[model samples]
Target: MEQLICLEALSVILGVPIKPGSKGMSNVNELNVENLLFSTFFGNLFNGGPGKELFVDMNGFLDPQFDYDFRYCNDKSICKRGDEPYKRPCGWYRFALKVLNKYPDGNTWLGTDGWRSHSVAGEWPVSYHGTTIENAKKIVKSYYKPGDREKYGRGIYSTYDIDQAFDYSREFTSKNGKKYRVIMQNRINPKMRKVCKRQDYWLIEIPEGTSAAKEKEIVEKSFRPYGILMKQV
Candidate 1:
């Protein structure tokens, strides 16, 4: 419901009040819900302002298969602070997405229960995908798409380094006029991943059963989106 309050905030910012059962509802309809998130779309997120009420919670929407507690990261290496201009300080406000059961047919990759870089045997390595706010929310609402860039031959393009992800991060201005970027935190199946260490990309080949990971839809079995990472630019 916080996301709703964010819509109210947006309406308030525009000097319009939401009248019950009126077209004011259109101000906060389904298609653009993510666009008006107060907690995420505004500038006061770190200052305990009303923007605090804008975080998107995945409570009732979670599939039973993805019901698990996700971890918060504080590592200095991968989760670098904002000292780097290209990258967002890692792991502050992460909203977990459904992932666990998305690839049930493959041998379950382990060690990603926390969404961290540390991996054990058979664990898929962690990666990051920087995208526009529109695309980020689209994947969260739906599922991951196959690679949009085919420089490496049509696979989901990602990076093991947060810095690289930041290089690809898309920037947008919020209704509040604050600039921001969105990053997808994920764990990729090493079995299907192609690492380009020199180029800093981890290209993941499309899995077989997905009709091209359900080309029209996004059921890509080779990768899973565990968290949506947003940062004010």
Candidate 2:
């Protein structure tokens, strides 16, 4: 069976060789920087690895600002659910970029607010819905009822709806197979009665002889040398 490499593994692969010793070395800093650069470059090259699949769901990450408390040194509550522990969307995107760079021809999948719950507290829209304009429109249209526009005008739903719509629009399918759909909430948010940011997905049809795991392995191994990591997280 082929092995799937993750960011840590990729980091080890890229960082270990350059360093003379496993122990502390001042020059290790430089090597680390170099590794990071290499990783970033590799990520950009592959563009999030081969799958041609996009999954849309609620943002699983947390809001960095309000979700934390710096007042107490050992405050456990400071780290809200899905905040400190996970790498979150930013890291996920970086990792994804690496995968994409390796598998440029693979399909792209996207989910709704699966990174962070929609909010109005950040500079960039506090949502992970749409990364493109067309997607934004689709999200809005899908979520809001034709005449219930005024309700979501200024609430979190306003921003959330826009972001989700954008993501939906950006999604594309290269080849048809089984289109998967996941609905987190049956009804739309009350604030935005028309918008429903549900989760939907689809996987490309693998060749007849290839198993799903085998195909994933083949793709993962292809990008291993390029410093891109591939694994189920």
TM-scores, all models, native as reference: 0.55, 0.19
lDDT (Cα, tens digit) per residue for candidate 1, span 1-233? 33343233333332233222322234332122222222232222223233223232233222234333222444445431111112323543454444444454543453534333333556556678887655554554445677467666665788767767878877766556766566676766666667665556877655545584265333355566565555555
What local lDDT does model 2 show for residue 3? 17
Q: What is the lDDT of residue 67 in candidate 1?
A: 31
Using alpha carbons, what is the TM-score of model 2? 0.19
Residue 47: error of model 2 in Å?
9.0
* Reference-based lDDT, each prediction: 0.49, 0.24
- In candidate 1 the C-alpha lDDT for residue 124 amounts to 58
| Model 2 ranges off by over 4 Å | 1-43, 47-125, 129-158, 162-168, 174-176, 179-233
- Candidate that scores best on lDDT: 1
